[model samples]
Target: MILILFFCFSFTVDQYIENGRPSADPVVVNPVMEEFDPTKKPEFIIKPRKQFADEGKVAKFKTSFEGVAQVNWERHGQLLQQNDKYKMYPALDFHYLEISSVTAEDAGSYTCIVSNDVGSDTASAVLEVFETFKPSPTPAPKKLELDVKLLDRDVLEGTQQVEFKCKFSNATTVYWLKDGRKLTENERRKMTFDGVFAMLIIKDISCLDIACYECVATSKRGEEVRTSCALTVKRDKQDCNDETGERSKAPEIVSVTPSDLSVKSGEAAMFTVNHTGDTEVKWYRGRREVEPDDRLIIDNKSGVGHFTIQNALPTDQGVYNVIVTNKWGNDSMLVRLHVEDTSIFDGRDVKISTENFEDFYILQDKVGKGRFGTVHKCIEKSSNRLWAAKIIKCKEKQKPDVRNEINIMNGLTHSKVLRLWDAYESPTGFIIVTEFVCGGELFERIVDDDFVLTESDCAHFMHQICEGVCYLHAKNIIHLDLKPENILCIAKSNNLIKIIDFGLARCLQPGDSIKVLFGTPDFIAPEVVNYDEISYATDLWSLGVICYVLLSGWAPFTGETDSETLVNVTQAKYDFDEDIFEDISELAKDFIQKLLVKNKDHRMTIQDCLKHEWLALDTVDGQIMKRLSTDKLKTFIARRKWQVPTPASSLKQSNGGGPSGKAFLNGGADHWHHSHHHRKGHMQTPRSSSYSNGQVPWKKNGNAIQAVNRMIGKFSSLSSNSSISSSSSSSPTSSSSLYSKSKQSS
Candidate 1:
């Protein structure tokens, strides 16, 4: 045996050297473990201690769960791990313990045995599989919503079904809590319910139930998983007294409203504020104290506090904050107030006025005072009609300029001049609603009709004006401003002219001289230079200037410099272009020269113009130039209005110009008669109401006033005719002849 051991030791040294292992001092192993003792009994015991591992991946922890108990893994109550849990005989020794294919089921109580040649012992251990995924934590409210509409509802209102869902995802189950108590405790009838979420069925919840409400969700593992809300149940039964008794003693703000935004510096701002939960409600501005007046004002009148800021100054322009203090807490809200300068208006600046465009359109403002109001387009709501509303800015210290314009327009019943329909006043300003001419201004038509005009075209346009203005002059009204832009062409109509912008017009007595300087600079008459005195002849001078521009297609005396032009006008000197003279005639020039004299006294009277050569029955190259074919004139008006003249119309065009067999192309005889009668009336504006006194009192209060004055004017004219009839029997025949001529032409 000794000789065999020595040979074995030498062989072990040679093997270690071949394997390249560092040599160590000879150390004894648990020598019995190196070889199997076939004749002796052996035992197996699980190594280490009890084991734990994740259920899903537990098999990776160990092959057969090497633990003190030598557990045999089991799954679904069946053995799966490579371990002999079903049968293991320790008396028959086994040295190599091996296992294959482990599973979570392998984790369980197991036994191991240790045996020697004489006896064997056993040890047991238990292995457990824990979860990697933990139970969710309890969560907070994800949403916070207020039920402000509750205040408008009746008491004992059943719960508006609401769903409180927890977003604690990955959690197996969710738990709900509310107001420091778990909502899991469902009440008998009016219970807090749980389906997909937690809900409180507020059965007959009154004001007493009003409180801060929220929710939270927890997982099965006692973890919060979701958020809730800060719910407020504004109970219906809650009042100031009841709220004070049931809840904390804090003040609360209610609703507030103000009377006006504008007040005098020393005036008061009236307001009302509603409150609850406060013993007393007070008001303030910034840091300054402002108190409510009334020694007998109740402290609990609907919980509303009425306040007035007396003698409010400019410094009170900031926020007016009101604080209500109750036993619970404080509540406040801020309001803004403004003070204005009250000296801008006088009481008389405004009047109750109506617009007759559409069934009496009515409004109130500084009608004629604002800059933009100087030119306003008003729509008569009733009729869906459009009207031009002109305002004269006659602020403090300025004479009522609008009165002057209206007086001039009202006096003149002229087709060329815009018709004065009505006048009104309001705190804002004075307003005049005149005839709406959809045709636009004359300058605008010049571009629309294309450049330059033929002599016949000029004659037609200027002749219409002569007729309208002559009617005005017959009533002793002067169109102080007669610029071409003031002349508007009727939209989709004949050669009708609607003169507008009477902002500088004036009415005069026969031979009366207006000593005011106002008119378009280019159109002003020489005699109006000083505004010292100007008569009907001054208008004649401007008329002469107007006709020259129309006939020659340019002003007769235009200079590069205003000074040069004014000097020429003042000197009564001018010459037409020689080049254009061939295109004009002596008759037209003579007509213009007869009126454009420096001395107002030498200006031609309207009657003198009646028999002028150009207006007389003159033959132009054997053709009657004075007569216009009614059929052709109608076609012309229609053509300009976008109507393509059919071949049928051309047949009538061959017969000169006129309305063909269309009869009257203008307004009916009724309108002509009205004009004829108005032609006889002595017209006046509100500015001359003082002059008329009781005889012709026309006011500018409203549409009713204007209508009344127009009637009175008609009667006055009828009365005046009686005197003319007695003075001259020939006058009636002459008037009838003039009316006949207009009828035939139209």
Candidate 2:
């Protein structure tokens, strides 16, 4: 048995050696089995760690695994793909995920999944996104102050040269004027400025050069400081005697053109005097001599004297006098200059009266109150006609806005638009006179229990509104704030309506697009909420909301909160409730539908609205006329009154909140209601007992006033940073997308 076992072991050993021996011809083996291991799995060699990134910055995650594996990326269990926003790279042992233009929504836990047939492993890291820093509000510029005044100078008639000097502070440029005409550098005249000092030198001075000399300094902010001095030229006795015993006689006036001149603002006005004189003439406005600036010119020739005003302003309206002297008797003639009010298209300056408002009209009881001013009913002293006067405090910061409104109102001539009679600027404030609207707001009329409103009536009102809007659109003007509160009737019994309040209106030029952060919450367009380019369709959207409210007593986009309402507007998430819209005709629904489209290009134009079949429909389905119930409208108005938040609440909400929260806190529901009731040209309701007795009640709620003031302040602050005009094409963005972008850039 031992011999047999030894022989078997020796054979086995010889067989093993034969099988394991190296040879020039290599023995083949199973390559997969040689490298494979049953217990092997993916193990992280370098795991991603927690990272922090600023919004709008790039974020990257990297990992390396020891075993062969396929790599994938996920955020909160949702698989991520390589697209414009995301990118992924995989190698044999390394993987990478990169996100571009990171936003607040990208902040979360990111996972890198590695898997193979054997097993799988995941490495997660938290990504913290932070907002970029925002710039602080710019402070108001300092007012330019004048420090010195020009002094009078005397020179001989044949003096070789004369110089006038003046000093000023905060002046960016200085201009020299003679008899109200701007001076230019020539052979005989020279002007020089050395920092704070301005000088004017005239060579070969003659009698004609003897007139009022003015030094006008202007700052970069357009603030002007003016000073004047008279230049008296002493004549030689021999020239006056003229080699005779009798002295030279003064010129005699023959004729004067335009003895009393009347011209519109921004128009050119000229007064020519035909006289027999050998000397020069000087012009004067009141006691002060008229200075020839860029817009005023004075000329004296062989036999005539002319005074011309170019682009006349309201302040230029006055009595002008011209005097001619030839060393003998002097002749003088006076002419009155009147400048009529012009539109913004004609001139930026509005004709404002320095006279007291009470001088022209008898101030009566207070009729209304607003965020910036108070309204009063007045009677024209000359015509005994009734009018409404809006009095606003003349704060330096608000003057431009008030003047802009006046200019816009002056430009409008349509009967359906509010008419501006006059405007007065006083020491303390401004008083604007407009047509008296006693019929109250459209909502007030709708709420009246005895008032009957039919679908046809709604159409008639809409027709008038469309006509007004069409006229405005033709002029490139868009009334951004169009609502029931802005529509006023001529009389309680008539259907005639007038649109008011141009504070939010804009005149868009070709290829102009503006983005502003202001509007009534219930009527704001989706573009407004998304901070996209605003166009004429913005007004059409408001019209659609107005029509919707008229037909159904509820707001289409109203929600429990302002932010929610904004979200609804951006998504166009409103439906026609059966209870409120069942009685409405299909054509009417179509009209509103066309106007309320989210894409501005798809919205109906003003001309289309005017020509729509619904406005021309006399009867619906050839049936009896249907009257809408006022109960819902009354409820809506009541709800609006209570929706205004107190100032304290707005302040609390604005503090320590996110971007959306702060925006809503500043210009959301509270601002909408406040602006609705307190806008310029708002009419008081006649339902109040005080109004019935010819004494309109001045309602003053402490909380309401405080809230309105706060709203106005908020508007001023935001307006400084809002309304950006861009040349880039506009693309529609959802509310959530805008929110994320705002967070990333705030």
Off by over 4 Å in 1: 1-359, 362-376, 382-384, 391-394, 447-452, 510-513, 530-532, 616-746
Candidate 2 — which pairs collide?
179-292, 180-291, 180-292, 180-293, 181-292, 181-293, 182-292, 250-329
RMSD of 2: 28.7
TM, every model: 0.35, 0.43
Q: Give the Cα lDDT of each candidate.
A: 0.44, 0.65
How many clashing pairs per prediction, in order?
46, 8
Model 1 Cα lDDT, one tens digit per residue, 134-172: 679868534332211111122232454433333333343
lDDT of 2 by residue, 652-699 (tens): 111121112212312223432111111234444322122233221212
Worst 10 residues of 2 by lDDT: 727-736
Q: Candidate 1: lDDT of 90?
A: 16
